[model samples]
Target: MQRKGPDRRALETPRAAGLAGVVFALLLAATIVLMRLGIPEGVEAVGAGGFTDSARRDAVRAALALIPFAGIFFLWFLGAVRAHVGDVEDRFLATVLLGSGLVFTATMFGAAAAATAVLAVAHPAGSAPSLTAWDFGRHLAYTLMTDYAMRMAAVFVSSMSVIGKRMGVLPRWLTAVGAVTALLLLFVSSNVPWAELVFPAWSLLLSAHILLVSGRRRRVTLT
Candidate 1:
């Protein structure tokens, strides 16, 4: 009986994951920035009396439009990474990773929905939402994004870091960066504006590393 060598398709998994991850990172970061600009926090958020400006409303709409694509690419990245890791993955950590990623995506969608509610306040079309409606919608959206979704992102980052450490796939520096990112998401993101950006930044770094590693491997295989 003859056993075949590893399938060439398998080698492409890391590349796919890398590309997906890069796209997800960029999209998510842009969405977050737009959302924040559209729905600013603090007393000024209420002071401004909310979305009187059509441009801000449009920015929120753009952010909402980007959310679905960001989530899709994130899922693709998640599945590809899992496929790349394959049978060597620890069951418990894998479960944690999958669970957190799913939760994060759902939370992001919830935030987008809340933001959409704010946009719909165009009751007669071009009319600003009542202050109360604006406040509630903005609060709900930020809460879901920073408090819930970012926490889930933290869980995903930390768990991936642990797995990478055990598997020796990620470099020590990258794992360290992941640890910092998780901590920031868990503790700082909810309180500090723009802190959630770390998650996407970390994702971009990880994706770049994966692409570099996979490219080297493919080159070596060819040689």
Candidate 2:
């Protein structure tokens, strides 16, 4: 009598991670947009006492509200990817991916916290925050977002690109795009306004790709 192997095909399921990635991409993009609009960087975009404007303050609060859910979906995406990779995943690259993603989430939260502090100080419905409070909170939030979170995002992109290349799962164009995204996050995002948008753009594209590929795989399997 011959021993039978477990049926791996039976374990196949819809790629929930890919869906989670899509959701994460959308949520993150919206959050970033709300934050930028709320706390405009240049003098032209926002003047003194900008925080006193209830509209901008509300935008910031909305962004803060979305951040935690975005982070949760991001973690879910990471875990799903790891589980999908299974035994074939490289330990080193996987470590970098997870570490960078974790740090990115943490730094984003830190930025949100800083923004919240600014909002707290600019309270009383029509009063400007103390100049010191506004300056410190704004700079801290901006620094955490542009400098720390984006740098970690760069690492995450690079690591994912490498892993996808090695796994032969990601297409050549996607890998190239990831490389460009990583570079943008690493250098341009800090100096250039709105450059950080590339990160979410890349994420959206990648997630879409994953979903398409998974659909193909399922079709082939069923056939």
Candidate 3:
């Protein structure tokens, strides 16, 4: 007796597309939040002397808030693309591409969380030129270069927007932005204050397109 394979046709639906779009929006929003308030891990307000211990603690709180969402967004982004355009392209390659993006996102989240937690706990209070304070500062610097900085580079270079266009899920212009944004990340991530602006800005554009395009398609079907 021969067994039947799974029904592939049943997997396709407008509902799936809509859900995927929503997930993408969520991922974009989470990334934006993480960018502005998440990674710095310390130094909240510019202290009188510059960067007090309290400021550092605030940064840690922001980073912690972003950790779960970062991971969730990676997984969610994968599912969204898989649902939206899987049938139109090489599923395996597309999955690998998405997995690459997710890997970078996850790496950033983990590193940020670890770095923030360390800084939060080890932060020096008041004016201390003690051994511990120096060590903590060194730790912060290391994490900045290794975790946040590197991850930003990876996200920019990976350029899922390119893949989305090739797969017929997004416009070429959008992918171009992804490409430009990815490239910009390398040079600008250090600017913390400004680097934080990229994700929200990108998200708003993409989310608006998703909603508008998806809605227009729905109307055409009804007519």
Candidate 4:
């Protein structure tokens, strides 16, 4: 009987996916930070003249520009994760992962659109947005991001952690961290200013793990 060599393509796919996940995590974290700094949560100040500041407006524009790229990379990350999971994935958990990820992306985009709307309405220098418009846009953007998108992200994280635990792909501590991240996103994100950052933190750790595992497998295959 002749021995077959390792499949190079199969070995490379996980590595590529891991890189994409890392990029996606960095992009998302940057986007969140920029948006938060640009749009401070103050109903009265924002309604008055806070947005008229050039620096804040520019920060918001920068954040808006990064959003599409973040979303693009996120889709790539999602696809890579699915590929890594392969055919052995549980249908119910896989469905939850896919659905929640998609929803999170869409909801994130919608939140960006709401923020853009605030900018659009604020155009024409020396003119501040009406209280009603400012309040609506601000609340809508935050609600979509913190309320809807974060919750969907929680589901995605929880499902992925469950799948990884069952498949023995993730360490016990990593899975435990994912569970804690999901709980924070689900219950604390809306109330805490920076709680949503946990999602990206979890993503970065997972991506780094994936990359490490892929590197090890590649070395073993090449030897």
Candidate 5:
């Protein structure tokens, strides 16, 4: 009886992860373009207290569409990570890491939707759309404060570092950077709001690294 070899699917995981990364990148790009067009006008109107009700509705709708893309990207991103880091330690760590990341990602959307729903109820139908500065501030804050931040901190600080070291995909330096970024995010949650933004940016970089490594088609070697 002959022993079975490693499944062909295992070899394809890297390529699949790379393709997913490309898709995720495109999604983020689209979301960013839409956001640039939507959020500024929306926030400006809210700040000036002059946005008409219809305009507010349209802007909110646009912004809402953009928000979901981030969630989708984050979720798919974890899938890509797990797909590439094909080892015991990497899998276990990625399981916890992805689980936490998704939890945070889901909560971010949940909170955003909740806030939007509350605002819709408060504003009601056909009422004057006079948004106060406080409303705008609160809305911005609501978008940022979430499990997304915590999970990012956890993943960047711990899981990615472990994956990077174990899999040898990303440079050790980048993994170290991820660890530092994660720690900064955890400690600077309130004082430095930048951590929230930094975490995702780092993730995108790491994702790009994974994509680069995986993009080339592998030559099969039966050993």
Candidate 6:
């Protein structure tokens, strides 16, 4: 009897997905950093002079441009993880992972839209946004990004960690890291400035692990 070869498509999918996850993490982290630098959280409202800093406006625009691509790569990353998990995945955990990932993406998009609205309102020459509109947009963007999106990311991380642990696909240290990241996102992100960066950091680590594992598997298959 001849030995069967590993499925090439199956071998490639996880690697590609891992790469997408890496890209997503970088883009998202950059977007967040740019937004933070460009829009500094404490601005209650534009003064009577109006917010007309061209440099900040350009930074915001750059952040906005990265968002869609980040979202797309995130979706690919999600699909890849799910595919790697395959049919043996627990239905409950899978549902949580999928739901949280999707909700996080949507919330992120909402935040970006709010940020874009802020930019649009300030774009007209010497036209200052009313205090009410400025405050509303600012609060809405932060709340969506730091509160809702981060919470959903916490859920996603916790669920994925549980799933990976149960399946023995992830190392103990990775699982521990995921748990800690989830806890931080859940309890600390909204209160602490820039804490949401943890999510992308964890994603980067996980993606790197996945890529490493995929490479080892490919080598084993080849041998």
> Which candidate number would show the highest lDDT if scored against the true structure?
1
Error of 5 at 85 (Å): 2.7
Per-candidate total of colliding backbone pairs: 0, 0, 5, 0, 0, 0
Residue pairs whose backbone atoms clash in candidate 1: none
- List runs of model 1 lying over 4 Å from the truth: 1-5
Best by TM-score: 1
Residues 116-200, candidate 2, lDDT per residue (tens digit)?
Answer: 9988888776688777878888889999999999999999999989988998989999999999999999989999988888988
Question: Global lDDT of each model?
Answer: 0.91, 0.85, 0.52, 0.87, 0.56, 0.89
Query: RMSD to the native, candidate 1?
Result: 1.8
lDDT per residue, candidate 4, 1-223, as tens digits? Answer: 1334336666666777778778888888988898888777855345547888777788889989988888888788888888778577878888899999999999999999999988887868647778788788888999999999999999999999999999999999999999999999999999998889999899999989988998998789769
| C-alpha lDDT of candidate 1 relative to the true structure | 0.91
Clashing pairs in 2: none
lDDT tens string, model 1, 104-123? 99999999999999888756
Model 6 ranges off by over 4 Å: 1-6, 43-50
Runs with alpha carbons beyond 4 Å of true place in candidate 5: 1-8, 22-59, 90-92, 118-153, 189-195, 216-223
Mark the 10 consecutive residues where model 3 has the least summed lDDT.
1-10
TM-score of each: 0.96, 0.92, 0.63, 0.94, 0.66, 0.93
Q: Model 5, 121: alpha-carbon shift in Å?
A: 4.6
Instruction: Quote the positional error of residue 68 for candidate 4 in Å.
Output: 0.8
| Residue 174 alpha-carbon offset, candidate 5, angstroms | 1.7
Clash list (residue pairs), candidate 3: 42-56, 43-55, 43-56, 44-55, 156-182
Best of the two (1, 2) by TM-score: 1
- Residue-level lDDT of model 6, residues 71-172, one tens digit each, is 999999999889889678879899999999999999999999999988888846737667677778878999999999999999999999999999999999
Between candidates 1 and 4, the one scoring higher on lDDT is: 1
